[model samples]
Target: MVDLRGIRHPLRPAGHGRLPAPPAVDRVRADGRRRQGLILGWRRRATVAVATVALLAVVGCGSTVSPTPGSSVTAPATSATASGAGPAPTCGPIPPVAPPSGLDQAGWWRDRTFYEVFVRSFADGDGDGIGDLKGLIGKLDYFNDNNVASQTDLGITALWLMPTFPSPSYHGYDVTDYRAVNPDYGSLDDLRELVKEAHRRGIAVILDLPLNHTSDEHPWFVGSKTGTGPYADWYRWSDAPQGNGWQPDGSRFYYAAFGADLPDLNLRNPDVTAEVTADAEFWLGTAGVDGFRLDAAKYLVEDGPTTENTPETHAWWRTFRSAVDAQVPRTLLLGEVWDLPKVSASYVPADLDLTFDFALDTGYVGAAQSGDAATLMRLMTNVTKLYPATSGFGAFLSNHDMNRVATQLDSDPGQLGVAADLLLTGPGVPFVYYGEEIGLTGAKPDERIRTPMRWDASSPAAGFSSGAPWESMSDDPPSLNVADESASNSSLLSRYRNLIHLRQLHPALSSGTWAPVASDSSSVVAALRVAPTETALVLTNVSTEPVSPTLSLESSPLCGRPAVFGAYGQTVTIGPELTAAGGFHDYRPVATLQPQSTVVILLGP
Candidate 1:
């Protein structure tokens, strides 16, 4: 171990005095082969855990840690204590880990709408007037009403609270203690009740798991610095503070790309692995959470923007999936994989399900906003070839992490009509963000993108809370809010509700495989979403004027059955109206697409 000037101080990890050895990080490189000779190829990353006094220093000293920027760290740092390591530690008879089984981690997450709530700024129950869990509890009904057209109508399937644990900052990413619940949010009892009540309502809950690093005040850092703590190996340390690790002590250290305050944990430490594994287990088994929406998944495998290309990252996910399944089965794991369809596909480890399709979200955003239907049609043509059919991707227009679709489409709501038509009619599970049905918009970086659900923008906290909202939004009547939309049969919200209900109306829309028929080649598209039992002819034209195209349906699994949609093109038989050559109308087109508009026709048995 590298020696440093001794600083006498007593410190220890916040929870256990000595952490259990962490699961091995070495396995990451093994599963995801690092290409040799590639610049910074992760395949060559050292597999050995670093042995250091820094973990000891951190746990003992009670010092604050601020990791340096752009730092790539190696986490497992403590030297393995020579044999006879005291009473062999107290944390129970945990079994050895095995490869993942294609089972669930936790239940209730599969078919739920995952609601993400920014805790510090959600709602305030007590006069203290801060949005807390209790406040959210008080307003559950509002959430329920928002899902009127969803599968259950009980609001979202799970509540993804930003971060409710104790930290110096408002957004609890810098965790001080894993077990401690922030009192401001509510007691641990409040969290338990939240889960209980949600479950009672057929809803599930998900929490932000920020295991990557911790706040500076963590006891492990302090105790390791001082002599009283024996758990320094709990966190990653460096041999020389100046190397890859960002160390203020000028002692070797380990760090992450996010920030130094959040020191990367040493997964190489078996104790670390056991602790996190147990934490996930406890949440799934004890806390009764539905599942997790993994954050920063792209950062784990190697240190870069493109994740799926590298195998190490996928291996890390596999480890998490396996560990979670062993504890609780039936859990849902949705990844935040922001990349092209090819790279994003890596995150779906066969059994590990659900990734957002960014190709359409970003590309469609660029095309539709310009009212270019031909471009949108061409992009979809490109999409059919980019991703795999069975991966089950999630198609969304907007989410808390990205720009609002309305804003992205430049507020020309007709674009939303076409976008929603494509969304509900596309080739994957569709997600509808809260308030998106009502048409929410915010300028870049203003966070209006994450505004509260506006049952009506006029209600108290827009019917979300009684206290002042943490963020302000742009005021627009007919263009914003749900109340007006619901009142007007033609409003965007009503249209969305209809679209959602429509998807359900035809099983073909939900379970079918997509096949391109024929397009006008420019501004109009007519394709088929066919299932074993149903065939849906989906059409959209995103332009300033309506243009019709005669779409034809001839082939599929039918091989010649005469079925049009609700099934495969090969399975379905062609009709007189839809021809292989010049489309319908006694051999003419149906109707030109509506200007900046769309239309979906259910053409089945």
Candidate 2:
């Protein structure tokens, strides 16, 4: 058995409290990984009883047996939690929040959960070892079967495909032909089929449009090397290697912000901008995709001395956005602006529909790793202020670029689940990396982080392909694969599924207004997600030790009795009177939060 008792919280200070001893419950341990079992003994029985009573009280079932004022309504822990467990907690159904008035149907992406897929690493088709459009089409049901009641699929509403354009590299970040699909991935017809299938299953497909640069072998880049033809001025060139990002091309040099092989396009040129705009329209109007995830959005047009987020870059985006909007007004343009939240927010409401929250990504991982909630709380509040009310942002834990959340959190499934809870419940649209739901672990070296998906544990390629995979599978254990986790309800994958469906079911989570809930302890982070009609209180214990922090819902309009949901492991009591501190109602969550766990309490009738 994997002894989790010896595992220390990375951010826990010296002499910090440790988790209580495991209970005498049936422990389900996995091989070569942290223990995947909850130690429910006496606490499990008591929680079930309290939850049953609480449910009756919430539904007004005429049960006189009111739960004792401070009686805990503990929830079953994830497979990695070291606390009480039984079945998932039974809670009242969360009322759905109505969409805002005059909300465009094209903006449907705002409330949907997005899944990012590296098509080359997702699944192999045609027995070719390489993942193709056909392979992804075959797995459409895995993302969303369009049957929410089944609860078997990942419940993904949108898919952000990482570059399908023909490219010299396996990763396809550097595009060669914008019009054609990569031969390895299949034909253009195959892409159309994938989009059709995805739409049939209620999944929106968004292609990764790397318009900032193209492969050096691209005909345009090749022609530009000779400094003649329509493509000559399409790329930025210097007589002799200019400044940073300029690469040697024969005797002359060209600007390549990403790398030498990826030559940056001169987006300042109306011809180049018009060409990219046409390509985007082709995909949306012809290929029938829902949107495009614009790669390197901030570096589209760089001025001398200032390479990123230049005024010219914003102008380029506005022009591009207007062109795309004119062609297909429904198209969602999500940008990959890897910068601070302020810089990212500047692109939205005009330039792009949404940009990834790079700051929140780091803040979420940092909060989880450090067992502190202050940073994440501050970031969420800032996001509310920075972006316009009409704009949306993409919230995620980790994407294709950084270390996977499982690895970032030391492969602790409990902490991983906590991060998912925050992402799904916090605000804006949540994006899940392809293998993230299954706890796929990888760090750096690019290729490793983009390995084949582990569909099953029986084969060397982990059922990713019958043939040799282009890249090896991650080092995560065989048991951590999808096939095994899909069978276990308490698995990390299941936790993600539950959270996603919860977000889908409640508007408070998907499109709610965010506000920080003041908590007494640094180890616990609390926030309130308020919709027009409903409110959700999200509390997370980032530490290894259980905490029962007093939360202040100050100056808020929360009036009804709260119904508890998710992995909460304690009784919650609302103070009848408002506290003197800012005249805010004091909510004492009497129940102790299990280490590395989160709970959502829905308030409002």
Candidate 3:
């Protein structure tokens, strides 16, 4: 596994291993009542006596809800309003957004928003103070309630669950049993139930599969240590310690890329390949997961001294892809090739259905931090040229391994909003880390980055658990927790909810050709999302000063006036189109973007 912290060392302390059996507590069902409590609490806090004119101004056309002062943008209205006219929204079945033209309807992952869930730190259903499948199951509605009209849910279409297999470590990366579920999380049956529930809400579930290595305590590694058994040769070994990654297993040294506790599996062995392939089949065919987030995909089959992006790695992925396709036709293989766009793109259209764009992630975070849009604009232009299509890449801000985006931006909600706007509006599938919506802040040392989800600010455990949390909650939960933010229309959570649902409502924003829009100001980044029947103009002012960028949309396919779909402290003015000598219409669009704000405009037929 490539070090997430940019350090090639074990994240946990030495002697860190499986946690002891949790003390049994009464199982709490994450049912409608619990979900209602969360919504009602938000309503109670947000409700205020206001003028009728203000209410009318706040609720715009097409279910738009005006955000509070200093908030980011307009969000869709949810059932749980400040008025509290009905029951609070709950976790329940939600329908998937319809696929746009040229996209496969069966490939439900495309044009969808995905949420990365670290199961252990998500929620505690059994009062064990650790997140489990049952807890996740209850919270599925918070991700997507399947109601097109409801704005309470996050409107995520897919989930990328961190490893759930039984392992010897807390992170669950080093698998001990590929087939069995981690007892700390739940049973295999609980996993099946989770898949069932998620699917019922039209949410696709993909597991984190670290095929490169297994825990040293695994049977295969245990048997291979002696260099004699049915599992002999299952792991690479040598008479002497070969190089940097080799660890002493008695007299013989074995390859352990991440650490000694995790042994690299000899995937070149045919039997090992077959066994791993079968394990994948088990999850798809039996457990009913939709796909896998292949961890450290580029380092799967290392060559001598060159342990990353090897030719053998591509070949093995092809073999794995073919085998999985033969068994399960539409299963997704999303790889984590944490490298430049060129290297990450090489694995797509053949080896993996999609790969995370590490370069884009850097560009996005950097632009937000520096407030200079030139680098981000250049990167987006290059990305449009490099990838096979927009769907081939996955765009994200920060993940569990990196410092939280909020912390990276120094907890500035405006900058956070700008970053989120770029991620959702830009091409490729977007993945949101848990608690990112409410601007949860955390820095590295890994555990802090993967802290418990802050459900309620007032709760002792931040509403993640009735008992003690697996890890301490992030520092600013009082202002950043879900309950408080859900109530405030101007909160970061509202901005995220608006942006996510806006993507769902518009096809071009989700799956369309990206073309850069030339802007006069270096602080403003602009692009056009063009589809057959729809076109969207996304403009962001990365700087802290208002920028009225004169956009050169001469090369864009847009024609006529465009309407504002969503705006945050921005106003648009459509400039007159001029006919050029080549019989082409040259269009100019001008937008006055507020400091650290974004606006989405739609060009209709």
Candidate 4:
């Protein structure tokens, strides 16, 4: 059937799976028209063996949850009693669950906060009307204040850059040259300097690698079309054309699962895998990038219905991971699996270090908007069990593929605070999309969602670029820009900064095991984070009206001191309430939580 001579490398292992196909959308034309396009995807698998160092040894254990300029709201004098208290609060560490089947116990990811950057919209160093590497270089201080005592930096430790390689498309997903940087962004030297500067501030840089397909204009595809040289078998082809992607090319038909100008790489061909692997090595070894966001990972290898999550695909990822780990032992591999948690989580313990947690994204947003605390609490409880104990997902509210979060929550400041509280306090490595901190909002047609970062409201271009932006800025920049929000004590930008710092300060909130504290109200999602040294009770009132919900937990006295809070700074009081049948203590608050507010209480033993 298929030739195996080139691919059956001795070190390569094997694996398999199936994923629901992603919705197919039109590829944007150079003229900006919507036409049928290939699906952009990301793939991943595990390594046969970890070498050089004990992966578990290099990674540290634990996590923390965020902060702002305002003071924490103090609790009132009244408290709840065990006998009158409704549901008894569940206290203590949740049993240490087993790591997902093959989870690599590399915990280094726990300490990093990933920030997604769409290069074209980030900042423009040149007056070419497009954001470039030099512009990103200039903004490094914004991410880290360079050891400044003020702590004004965004404090993000990892950067997930959308594809940086040369491509014919504006999105850069249909890569034309794997080894070179797109001239629109900058030169290879510019990228090197960017990486060097980022590392100088203790930040890790990871480039998005689109490995599923290449621009039809790629030399390998052109060569393969003629069935000449080693490139002859570099892409999928058939004499009797079949399936959704079959397209005519000279004497034979080739497959393009995404854009018309893109051709799916025939990863079954060992040469293709070898070449892609080499490209990764170049970036990791020569370019000095920390890792990669594997784009379009699901469509790596097709089997019958579609080329997604097939056994061969997992096997290839394993080989790929091995090659990368061999070069950089601590390098991270985050997969872009835009599927359900069950489907995406399947890639972990072996395949990827993390997958974007779409469940939490949708769950938190939905519950926050509708005040359905049960749904949010259920999602959190389930996800904690689904993922490996040692590994975690990329907790995010919104990314380039989806509508901006501010747009999702209709720009409600309280809903935004609830979202930030859920994501930063929950267990996982969180990624904040650029401009999200300033409450950026955008909707469909794609370009709107990728608008330029709003750095200043006073400037005509919002301080993102001196020249015209590649895309227009969001209309409300004057009120929502970073320049204005950074100064306000109660602004969304200040909220995000404070929240991030909160996590950096507390180890329990970040890496600790999560246990849901039973609450009687449907409007509030309350839970406790328990670590060896500390315990915290997090409460969110997803309602628009002030509601006082009882939080029943077995823990001792709550300090009545709010560790971190958002929304209306109402006073909260924790007192003894009625007891349940089990004699567990009920903790009810004396103060009402204002609509859309969240509070974190540090409990004492």
Candidate 4 regions with alpha-carbon error over 4 angstroms? 1-106, 458-460, 553-584
lDDT of 4 by residue, 1-605 (tens): 11111111111000100111112223456897432211111101111111100000000012121122242333233334455443433233222222211112244566467799999999999876689899999998788655534446776667999999888778898888899999999999999999999887767789999899998888998888887788998998888577788888767888888856888998888888889999998998777888889987878988876667788777778888888888777778888887888878888858877777788889878987887789888888888778875236878999998899999999988888778767777777889999888899999878889999988874557888888877888866487787888787678777676666555444455555576778878888887665433455677778888777766655332222221222123333443432332223445543566667666554431
Candidate 3 segments whose C-alpha is farther than 4 A from its true place: 1-106, 559-572, 575-591
> Which model is ahead, 1 or 2, in terms of TM-score?
2
Task: Report clash pairs, candidate 3.
Answer: 91-141, 94-146, 95-146
Q: Which structure is stronger by lDDT: 1 or 3?
A: 3
Candidate 4 local lDDT, residue 293:
93
lDDT against the true structure, per candidate, is 0.52, 0.70, 0.72, 0.67
Alpha carbon lDDT at 136, candidate 1: 79
Q: Candidate 3: minimum summed lDDT over ten consecutive residues — where? A: 1-10
All candidates in order of TM-score, best leading: 2, 3, 4, 1
Question: Model 2, 1-605: lDDT tens per residue?
Answer: 11112111111101111111111222224563323222211111111111100111111111122233353433322121112211222223222223321112567776688999999999888878899898999999888776523557777888999999888788899898899999999999999999888877767889999988999999998888888888889999988766888888777888998889998999889889888889888888778998889888888888886999999999888888888888778889899999888889988888988998888888888887787888778877888778754227898998888888888889887678778877877777899998999999999998888989999986758888998888888998888788898898778888787677656555557666677888888887787665543456677787878887876554443432223322223343432222222123345644566777776655532
In every candidate, how many clashes are there?
A: 90, 2, 3, 49
Q: Judged by TM-score relative to the true structure, which candidate is superior, 2 or 4?
A: 2
